[model samples]
Structure formats: C-alpha cells, structure tokens
Target: MPVRPADIDLAQRLADAAGAVIRPYFRRPAGLETKADQSPVTRADREAEEAMRRLLDAERSGDGIIGEEYGEKPGVTGRRWILDPIDGTRSFTAGRAIFGTLIALVEDGWPVLGVIDQPVQRERWLGVAGQPTLFNGGPTRTRACPALRGAIVATTSPHLFAEGDVPHYMALVTAASGGAPRQGPVYGGDCYNYGLLASGHLDIVCESGLKLYDFAALAPVVEGAGGRMCDWNGDPLTADSAGHVLAIGDPARTDEVLEALRGAVDDGIAHDH
Candidate 1:
C-alpha cells in the first residue's frame, strides 16, 4: 500500500516521543551497559525505545516492530516500524549532538517513510515515498556531485568495519579523493550523516555492519532528496539486504561508486592467489 498521510504523521510522532524521552538524559550519565557485541547502550536508549513502543502499541498495534533496544514484535499487518532510538550511542555518551533518533515505516520489505530526529539540535528530517524530503518542515534536496573525485564522503568510523571489509572501504575513500593518498572520509555522525546528506550538506555516506533498523529509515530520506541509497552492488536496500550501505547525494555518481567497490573486491581476489 502507498504511504498515507497518517503514516507520515505517526512517524513524526514516534520521533517526537523518542526525542522527549532522550533529551533529559543528554550530557548526563544514563547508566551505560555493554551489549554482547561490545556496543554501548544506555538508559536513554532503552527508555526512548520503550516510549516509542508504547505509542505504537496504542496507535498502530497491528504493525510489526523491529527496534534496536527491544526485540521484534510481530503483527497482523505486513507493515513494520523499524526504530533506533539512539543511532549513535557512543556519541551520545560523549555528549555529542550528532546522534539521532531513527524511525521508518517499511511495508512489505520496502521503506516508505522515514524520520531522523536530533533532539538536542531540534532538527528533524522527514521523508515519505513519492515526496520530497523535509528538513525542519522545509523541503530539502541533496547537492549534485557529478563524479566521485572530490566528493565529500562520510562514514561513522573505520573501526566499525569488519577486518575483511576495511580495504574495500578504504578504496572508496581513495577514489573519492581522486586517487590521491587517502585523505580519509568524514568520520562520525552515524545516522546524522544521512540527514546532512539529505539537506545538501554531504555527498556520500558508506557504512557496514548495519541492521535493518539502521538503513531502512535512511533510504527514504536520501532517495526523497534526489539521492540514492543502496547496497555496495548498487541494488536497492530492503529488509533482507546485507549490511553494506552506500548513500550518494547525486544519482549520477552511483555507477562510479559501485565500480570503486567492485574494483576493490576484484583486487582482493587477485591478491589472494
């Protein structure tokens, strides 16, 4: 089903609810805990997600929920609400305002609506399928970059990449800098990078080790702003996609980015022999 106005409203409401829960804990110690994967989680993350879940249960009880903090909850409707109450827990712990709350409505595996809310900054980006993305209630479009050379690319961090995937990530960074010595990508921002890209402040964002809650909301925001968000192979993102994600502000640069990644993989294979 096409995304209805009501769905968009609910997404914004969800972000607002999450933001309200998270704001009080910003810059204050919130009882941090490490998950099994060594990722940090805090009371803010848990409480914010729980707040959003409560709203969903009351308003859209039939929709499935897939949250970063809480486990999945199945529903009768094929629609699912994917959420990451705090997309950058590390940044949040350090009191950086780059962290954000992510909410997306995925219907039958495709993201149809998304919201990226940075409560501390009071900035919000909402993207609905078939509509332009909005930043703080005003329409926004990504800047055009015709080529990979000189593109302002961003990734949360290289440390997050798996050992085998580091080279491929670096290859793209090198390509973006025009084959020069790798100057490195803009580090940090997490989901906030995607929001900036939607607002024309960034060009590309490449990330791996993401779950559905990470990129599902991002595709709508990026694509709605005349950009493209896809896998390394340039395939459209879906619920079942592997974690590798590439977001380019200009659609024209899609092929070039994909080629860079493919070249890296091929070079690795050649070296393995």
Candidate 2:
C-alpha cells in the first residue's frame, strides 16, 4: 500500500537514519576515502545507507530503495525510497556544518514526500507535494524578489570546475538578471546553498556532475515552494539521471539563463564530440 501524504513520520524515521550514522562519526575522526570520481567517501556515508536500507525493509518491506552509496533493490511494490545519505561529502569530511541528508519517497515515479535534513545546522526541511513546506515545522515560502537584478545565484564545483568550464559558467552568471559587482573572485557553500533556495534566500543553484541521489531528494522541496528543479535543458529530474540541477524562482529569469547555458554547454560538447 502506498503511504499517505499524512505519513510524515515515515519520512522522519528515514532522516533519523542519517543522524544515526553521523552520531558516531562526530565522536571520532572521520574515516574518509575517495571515490573513482575523486569525491570524498566516508564511513558515515556508507553506514547511513546501510542503516536506512534496513529500516526501509523492516518498515516498508515491499517498497524499493535507490541509494547513492548502495544501488537499487527492485521491489514487488512500486514505491521507492530515494536517499542521499550525505549530500555534501566534502563538507562532511571536513567536519563542516554544510552537508545534509536527503530522504524522499516516490510512488508511481512521482515524488510525494521529501526531507532535507541538515543535522549539523540543526535544521530539517520537509515537504509533501501539495502541502506547505516546513523549516522545522514552521511554514515557509520562497522569497518574492521583484526581479532577477540583485538576485544572488549560488553554485559549486566539486571537481569539473577547474577544467576550463569556469569561464562559460562565469559568463552566464555575469549576464543574469542582476548581480552585486564587488568581488575579485567568487565561491559558494555547496548543499547548504540548496537550503537557501528552499528558504528563498537565493535565486538559483546551477550544478552538474551530480548523481541521482544527489538531486532526487531536493526536487520536491524546491518545487513545493513554487520553485523549479531541472536538468540543464529544463527537463524534469529522475532517480537515474543526475546530469544537472537548477533551482530558480523566476521562470522567465530561468528560461533566459538556461537557454544561454544550453548554448554554451552544447558548443563545448560539440567541440569535444
């Protein structure tokens, strides 16, 4: 049976699984390793997935689970739990308070319950498709910025940033609606930036080099607040495809920006292909 939207507790328990893994890591030095992609991997990341998998099997026995560290377990039932145990591995490995645990439920291939748990920040953001989003149970809405001018867009480069793609990304950011112009250089705060998008504190987050678990749990919270999450071409996100994610409030502003991005990325791809 499909869990009802009122079953927020189910989602809550899943988020708690991540906290369980982090608790022990917080007590000792992080046992970190590297992925083939050159990204940090930690015991907390793997243990969190293993823990979450166990609960999902015990609680929602018939449902499937698609995880980042672990792959998928096709279920007799159609419901699936999509998890990113730690969305910001770099920050987590550094013991910084920026990464988050993402837990979401999808039924018939559509996201129904989404939880973005930032344990370090002591905030857990939750959303159901038709309900108001909550920042620790208080209702929240996206910021109603008058225009894109002065709107701040946040993003990060986990690895591919320095491979000469920076110039194109910078050009698009420079050409967006409006921006503050005082920096000799720039940087961003990673997955915490997505929390800003959920809070409406920022305008957009454009990213690539992502995996399914990286973006799955984020789509609902962003979309629930009247924002949008899409691939580089404005397509919907999927549990299997994590090519790109864009969080933007203003569609006109986003369409304007993404069109340029597609052109630039396409041009680069054409040269390489």
Each model's lDDT: 0.90, 0.72
lDDT of 2 by residue, 237-273 (tens): 7755545667786555776666556455446511111
Supply candidate 1's per-residue lDDT for 178: 77
Per-candidate TM-scores read 0.96, 0.86
| Candidate 2 ranges beyond 4 A from true positions | 1-7, 161-168, 177-188, 240-242, 263-273
lDDT over C-alpha atoms for residue 125 of model 1: 92
Question: Could you tell me which 10 consecutive residues in candidate 1 have the lowest summed lDDT?
Answer: 264-273
- Can you write out model 1's per-residue Cα lDDT over 193-258, one digit (the tens) per residue? 999999988899988878999888999999999999988777899998878888999999998887
Residue 166 miss distance in model 1 (angstroms)? 1.0
Which segments of candidate 1 are over 4 A away from where they belong?
179-183, 267-273
Number of backbone clashes in candidate 2 = 1
Best by lDDT: 1
User: Candidate 1 — what's its lDDT?
Assistant: 0.90
